[model samples]
Each structure stands twice: as structure tokens, then as C-alpha cells.
Target: MSELKTKPTLMEPKTFIDGLSDEKKRNDADALLTIMSDITQQKPTMWGDSLIGFGQYKYQYASGRKGEWFRVGFSPRKQNITLYIMNGFSQYQHLLERLGKHKTGKSCLYINKLSDIDVDVLKQMIALSFQARFDSEI
Candidate 1:
């Protein structure tokens, strides 16, 4: 089987966040690190050079492809911040309605900035996604 390209690295999550060239992105990434950490109660890890991941889940497909992935994660990107909400957004319509300006693609939640959204709702979404992924894995 082919290997997954992105895996955890030894770099500290905060250190990676701090190295971001954009001051605003750095601050937002830091806030996100805290939010995800609080929700998952797990230390963050670098998945590849960009994705800041928390917790983990293992999966094995019917074809016998087995792998592990982050329960939840995010990356500060040039266009916007991209959050990996493993459980997808359809089940969180209520939170999305109150999430301010954002976009979604399957399990991804994209926001232009933290100031554009209701943080409390985002926290709920992250917490729910983390728990849901955990439950689904079992």
C-alpha cells in the first residue's frame, strides 16, 4: 500500500505557528491551537509542514488500506484558514447559521478570519466534530 504523505513531526505546534510570516495569521493560528487543544485535550502536532493536528484516529478500509489521521486539524492558508472538521458540516447547520461568513467543502470549514465568526459556535463545532469522530471510530 502507498504511504500517507502527511505524518506527525517533532516540531512544537506553537513554534510552527510563531514562524508564520503574517502577524494576524500567527495570532489566529495561536488562538486556533488553544481552541483545538481545549476541545481535544490533546497536544497539537504538525501534520506535514502546515496542518496543525490534534488527537488521532486509526482507520482500515475494506480494501485493507489502514492508516491514522488527526481527529481535527487546521492550517493557515493564503486564501483563508482551513479547519478539518472530520464529521462534516451538514449535521451542524445550526452552528453554521450562526458561524458568520464562511465556506465549507465536505469536512473542511474555511474562514477568512477569527473576527468574522462567533468563536463560541466554532468551539462547539470543533468539540462536536472531535467527539463524533471518536465515537464513529469505535
Candidate 2:
């Protein structure tokens, strides 16, 4: 059997947040960092340079393509904040209705302006994602 492509690395969890350049983006990053951190009950890690990743898991496809990825993560991108939830939003359309301004793909939720969304709703979304992933695994 093939091994996982990448195992977790010992990156300084806090440094990733320190590297943000834009004050607003940096602050945004910090806010998200705290939310994701709390939801995952895990420290943040730098997945690449721009992504702040939380807990991780391993996956191997039927075809034997294997990889390791964080349970949840986000990137403070130039356009917007991109959240990486392992599951998609279709499962939680009701929550999205009250989540305020955002967009979604299969596994990504995009928020350009934080002020446009209810922070509490955002927290629930995070918690829902965390719980959904946990429960799905059982």
C-alpha cells in the first residue's frame, strides 16, 4: 500500500498569523484563527504559506491516491476569506440562509466582508462543520 503523501509538520502555529501584511486582513486572519482554533480544539498550522489549518486526517481513495489534510482550515485571500471545511454546504443550507454574505463550492466557503455576516452564525457554521465531520466518521 502507498503511504500518505504528507504527515503533519512541526510548524510554529503562531507564525503563520504573524506573516499577514494587511492590517484588516491580518485582523481578519486573527479572528478566523481564533474561531477555527476553538472549533477544532486544535492549534493552527501553516498548510502552505497562506492557509491556516486546524486538525488533520488521512484519506486514501479507492484508486490508492492518498493524502493528508487538515480537518478544517481557511485562507485570508486577497479577494476574500476562504474556509476549507471537509464537507460541503449543501448539508446545511438552513444555516447558510442566516450566515449572511458568503459563497460556497464543494468544500469551500467564501466570505469577502466579515461585517456582512453574523459572527455568531459564523461560529455555528464552524461548529456544525466540525461536528458533521466527526459524526460522519463514526
Candidate 3:
């Protein structure tokens, strides 16, 4: 198995956000940081280079892969905000219904802009996602 990488070492928000070339992406990252921190009740940390993460949990896959990762997190990618919800969409269909325009993958929700979605609903989704992670004991 590959050695698990530690979380990103960069801690300064300004430098981290400035590292993003797009102004809109930087702003989106800030907004997501606020939302995630509020819901997770944990300070934001720059995960890898681009993902702004809050709170963390360790997961051990049945395949014998194990690592530490944020319980809930988001990455302001070039095209959209990639929301990481480890539980996936099967359990959050109702919340997704209220989330406005978005797409889902195995563990990511993709949205082009925060303005295109409901802020309150997004917060609720984050809270619910975090709860689901805990409830599932993952």
C-alpha cells in the first residue's frame, strides 16, 4: 500500500486563496470554507493544494485500505465546487432535491456556483452529510 499522505501543510488562508488563479474560484472557496466550518464546528484547513476541508475522520476500507480524511469537505476546482460527502447520494436524495442545480458522483457533489444553489439547503446538506458519516460509524 502507498503510504498515507499527511494533510496539506499550508495554513494561511490569504496565501492559499491567492494561489488560485481565478478570482471567482477563490471567492467560492471562501464561501465553502465558511459553510463547512460552521457546520463541522472545526476550523478550515487546506487539504492537498486546492481542497478546503473541515473536521476529519479516519476510514478503514474493507479492502484493507486505511487513511485519515475530512468527514466533509469541498474543493473549488476550475469548473465547479466539488463537495465531498463520503456517504454518497443514496442516503441524501431528499436533501439533494432541495439543493438546486448539482450533479453527483460516488462521493462528490458538483455545483458550478454557490449562487446557483440554495445556501440554507446547502448548509443543511452539509450537516446531514456529517451526521450520516457519524451515524454510519465510518
lDDT per residue, candidate 3, 1-138, as tens digits? 886765755676557877888888888887887778778898777777766677778777777787777778888788888999877788778888988999999989999998889989888878877876453345
Candidate 1, residue 130: the lDDT equals 85
Candidate 1 vs candidate 3: the TM-score winner is 1
Assess candidate 3 and give its TM-score to the true structure. 0.86
lDDT, residue 38, candidate 3: 74
Model 2 agreement with the true structure over 3-101: per-residue lDDT tens digits: 644445566646766676777877888888888887779878877667777776666666666677777888889888998878777777888899899
Clash tally, candidates in order: 0, 0, 0
- On lDDT, the candidate that comes out on top is 1
What's the true lDDT of residue 50 in model 3? 69
After TM-score superposition, the amount by which residue 8's alpha carbon in candidate 3 deviates from its true location, in angstroms, is 3.5
Identify the runs in model 1 with alpha carbons over 4 angstroms from their true place.
Answer: 134-138
What's the TM-score of each model vs. the native? 0.94, 0.84, 0.86
**Order of all candidates by TM-score, from best down to worst?**
1, 3, 2
| 2 or 3, greater by TM-score | 3
Candidate 1 per-residue lDDT over residues 10-105, each given as its tens digit: 988888888999999999999999999888999899999999998889887776777888989999998899999987888999999999999999
Residue ranges of candidate 3 with Cα displaced over 4 Å:
134-138
lDDT: worst 10-residue window of model 1: 129-138
